[model samples]
Target: MNIAKNMEAIFVAAIVIASATSFATAAVRAPEVITVKAEATEMPTVTITAKRLTAEEKAAL
Candidate 1:
């Protein structure tokens, strides 16, 4: 019974140590950053349209 308890304690300790090491390494590591570049092109043309309102249309408003 004592031997069984000792083995169980060692197993639990091993698991705790493994978990702590994994967490420590993760905390010490830095995140990677990636950058992207894009080239600009000439601006596209824009068109505007206008129409004269009829006297009757203006009167309706």
Candidate 2:
């Protein structure tokens, strides 16, 4: 029974240590920055011409 209790304590200590180590390493590590360069291009221009239909043209249709 004492040995079993000692093993349980060891297991819990191991888990706590592992969690603390992970947190410490994460806090100590620095983040990486990635940069991308893209070329800018001009878009093509579009022109549209529209005429309103007269009353006579509507009647013809």
Candidate 3:
């Protein structure tokens, strides 16, 4: 039982080491950045008039 346990532990350790080594040896590439020019836009304006009403006119049904 003890021997089997030691072998299992060794197998797990070897797999972990192999995975880490392969990841370390992989090629790394840098990302690219792009520059763009934006066009300016004009905003539109709005004008409004306020009408006044009496309380008696507002409460009438």
Which structure among the candidates has the greatest TM-score? 2
What TM-score would each prediction reach against the true structure? 0.39, 0.39, 0.38
Model 2, global lDDT: 0.88
Ten residues in a row with the worst lDDT in model 1?
A: 36-45
Error of 2 at 45 (Å): 62
TM-score attained by model 1: 0.39
Clashes of 3: 0
Q: What RMSD, rounded to one decimal, does every model reach? A: 12.4, 11.8, 10.1
lDDT-based ranking: 2, 1, 3
Off by over 4 Å in 3: 28-61
Candidate 3, residue 18: CA error in Å? 0.2
**Candidate 2 lDDT over residue span 1-61, tens digit each:** 6877699899999999999999889868577999997676976789879898999999999
Report the CA-based lDDT of candidate 1 relative to the real structure: 0.87
Q: What is the C-alpha lDDT of each candidate?
A: 0.87, 0.88, 0.82
Model 1, span 1-61: residue lDDT tens:
6877699898999999999999889868587899987665867788879898899999999
Q: Where does candidate 2 stray beyond 4 Å?
A: 30-61
